[model samples]
Target chain A: MPAVVIGLADDPDQLSQDLQSPYPILPVGALFSASERQHLSDQYTPVEFAAACKPRFLNAVFARYPTVETLLYADPNVLFLHSTQPILDRLRNQTLLLTPYLLQAPGDTGPGKKAWPDEKHLQNIGLYNADFLAFTRSTETTQLLSWWQSRAETRAYIDFCKGLCTDQIWLMHAPVFFGGITIVHDPSWHVALWNLPQRQLHQRETTWQLADNGQPVLFVNMKGLFNPDEGFFPHQTRLNPAKRPDVMALLQAYRQQVAAKELAALTAIRPAYGMKPLLPVVRGWRRTATTALTALNKWVDTIYLPALPR
Target chain B: MTLAFTICSINYLAQARTLGDSLRRTNPDYQYVIGLVDKLSTANLPADLVPDYPMLEVDKIGIPDFQAMCDRYDITELNTAVKPFFIDYFYKNRPEATAVIYFDPDIIVFQPLTELNKALETNSLILTPHTCSPTPDWERPNELHHLNTGVFNLGFIGLRTDKIARAFVDWWKERLVYECRIDLCEGLFVDQHWVNFAPAYYQNVCIDKYLGYNVAYWNLHERQFSQRPDGTWLINETDELRFFHYSGYNPFRPDDISKYQTRYTFSQRSDVKPLFDLYCRELLANANEQYTKYPCVYIKPPTIKRYQRVRKAIKLPINRLISLLQHR
Candidate 1:
């Protein structure tokens, strides 16, 4: 279980030194060659530059550990509460695995639940959660990763008009086009705020149990939880902590760890190689004013006034 | 085995060609056929460039007084009037066919029709409603319009060679032969409005509300579209977009995906835009510009002589007054 730490900070060395894990922490900058860095820099935004590194990092890991049959790529934000042996056992027969946001559509009855993460919301973001992805080293896995890498290199933004939400949106079709896919419906595998309404995490003796069924909770992806004092928010805005008291202890522990990480110290860090960084205020202002117009122009070129149907 | 066909005249050959091409790409196992409601006259050069699929002209379908029926009904009526006859003809003639499907010439299939085929395995008849869910936008042509025009969009229908389908064909044929007209006053809208009672009248009828099937402008508000990484399309997050009905889409105005409904536009409702571009290219590639000029042999392109125009102008107000009085 060699974990690769992707440093989007100005000084990846300092960031890598701060991390302590049981597995080896391989810094991404040390892994990439000079020419590879130049090639990646020419094509990615700062955020995309970091997001696109996941596949390259995994490819490197696969090369370094040829004996390893299954390689898992989880976002840094995910926290594990149990052993990963079950996930490994499940991945033995499958080439790739993903988890859907919700096993069934969430009804409009719960507090703050009816409004969003609705049918259309899931359609825009993606059907499958990319927080935890595991792949076995095989031809199909290689092809799938390559396909995802190609899409990420070009358009890995949160633009709903282009049907993009980083690399997550593209996985919606992985099952249909890539022969078939194993969508992990196990509630305990990768839980998150989006699916919290349906999945309740109760701390049972020794381990956390999924309240709906007594399946042991493996991990919870703290995607949208924010420390109010720190003032950083996730993309989603509707996660109410008052509704989820059962998971409060887990959330507090993660928040303390987040605070300990001194994320504010590295807030100004930009990727060493990528497009110029625009100020967040300017980016927001320009994005709000230009998204619709740019969408129209892109539609005309690629879809509306296309030379061929795409 | 299943046989599918679209009923059209020479003028609709381009659309028919596009439909045939899509069927070959998506659902190639089924035997595709077309029912032409016109004679292969000498001047119509489209007869030379007919699509590769087997075509059954009106006369070959063995209907009595077919030419007279063609002469009486206008283009819309004629195309619809012959639907049941074609269904009956295929089921009776093609011994190998277990089921028969119908698609409007303007529709293009996108995915394998396993859902429809699966429905046919148990059910004898299938119909798609103008909408499965009520539109939130309260405007003209709401549920009432669908009720008035037809509850079922006759553009697509599936029939198995079972007792119910055979009975349905016999019953539908009897009404269509005489009653297939666009007379709103008589509560008639070709062959579509009559199928509103199919669920009640038949033993094994399925109203297929699959989100992906029979998607069109009227139902666009209900269905949302997203593209997979591999460029395949899905509808409402789960189901694959099986087929789209390009009803009232004008190739000339390529910007507008549909001419009939105003509920969707290119800018706001751009999910269906890719579908429009693909359908347009298919239609144009199938010789849309050239085929549009070749009029149907049976329905004469109405020639407006100056004297007739003058006479109609003189009598227009009197006809309107009489129509208003009769309605009153």
Candidate 2:
């Protein structure tokens, strides 16, 4: 099956390397050009940059490609380490694949339990993360577009310039609307930064990730970090970098694997991240390092605001 | 003692909890029963929010109020009852609690319900009728005409745990024994409105007066309300209102929750700016957090049929320009 990775071509360079994934990548763009696409409202809103780019990104992909069998999706920031066999295995018989929300609502009672918050976050975010999307090509995609089209007909503009509708709410019942969607959410597929620190790089799930999910890492979704802003790997969340020795060991014997220029290109992009000399940077962020000490002093006022007591 | 039973399913639980917490605070000793439709769990509500009260969890009665149905057009928990069945499990099993009082999680209490209890003096059953009629002829049970449930609004009811209330409950059981509907063609057989007959047969009191009780929408301006120098609201043609049951708009904020409690609701359009902002803040602070109201939406026609005549061209632009100039 030809797996299609559908995401907006916000960064074409990342889209090119992302094309070399285990499954083929299908880059989508919005109706507007990239320069004109970055629309923002004057008010400070809780909706993030990538989330605002949803309607255009969605319109681009569904309108462009008609034959999508499987979807291997990622955000522009997602970086690959090795061939993602485990993820594909889970999604083998699936029609759609999505990850769990990384940001947990306060007082989330874990899975199969109570989830209550006396107060909803005042942050007016469109609910769903439009990051990675996986779906088979069918009439199902049109159903979503029609539903969204009906909502957008109102032409009401609310917080975040979202036309008063939330992006996340649209997909909440996608399965019910578009039959046969397999929500494959292994943490290995989407290792987000909200749940990871430099120390927990070996294992981090998105949205308050835990440290010990024993499954082998398939693909690393390199999101939530923004620093050098060139290629995919040059983001700021790479405070401490780890060479995937585990992946290196697997590919060491495959001589033909060297031809996968995507891996080499990903490696070459690493130097631009400023964390080039990894061993020293790790020490710099670690305790007893003067960089760590000085950094804390500089950010204390900004970071240490009075918290709403738990 | 009277029993009040309010059921809030998981759908409106957020708004329900806010109302529940406030009611619990205002009437600490009142007989109250909270029935959760599905009995879901939550971290937001503290365990002590409703201390020493019995929580009845049961399957959704599967009834919808026509008004609440339209309310859903605007926008828009459980415990105890689990296992084999809820009624036999909660009512038959529990001995410590004598009566049940159910409050929709949306209601917030502004004052102690000493008045409702006092109203329960003679009758074994007490009910607050819809403060104002949905229409003029709503009271007559024409069947085709919408039933005036205020004649039997379950919003607040008192049931004598003894003969009368039990008999009413017994009657309700037999009626629900057949095609039980909380709301039907022009009547409801559940949601205490079914108990409207309890008063005719058993004995009940109907709370009727627009003295700021229940969902009363005063249309005319001068008739809406009167304010004194001391800031106490005096409903026109009336001396005092027990509690201004905020029914139309948001009851928590001043702009919505009328009766001169605070000017927050209408403050945005007021002459006094700083005071408006400060008063809104205070009202919001007093606004109970338990209820996160989900507003409903409705598809409204652009204009009424009488106004539809304006679509004939000449008066349309003239009216529009006049309205715009007036607005400006």
TM-score of the first chain alone, every candidate: 0.75, 0.46
List runs of model 1 lying over 4 Å from the truth: A1-310, B43-48, B301-328
TM-score of each: 0.48, 0.33
Q: Write the per-residue lDDT of candidate 1 for residues A1-310, one digit (tens) a residue.
A: 4455443412355454555554565666665676766676666665556666666667777888788888887777788889888888878868788777766434442234445444344545555677788888888877777766766655565555444566666665465335325777677888877777677778876688888788888888876665332111233444677767876777877888888877776655545766744224222444344445444433433332213344
lDDT per residue for candidate 2 within A61-176, as digits (tens), equals: 65666554445546655655546555556665555665544322233222343332111111122223345665554565555555544343222123322213234434433433
User: Model 2, A93: alpha-carbon shift in Å?
Assistant: 8.1
Model 1 TM-score relative to the real fold: 0.48
Per-model clash counts, in order, read 0, 32
* Window of ten residues with lowest summed lDDT in model 1 chain A: A227-236
Taken over the whole model, the C-alpha lDDT of each candidate is 0.71, 0.39
lDDT of 2: 0.39
Residue B221 of model 1 has an lDDT of 79
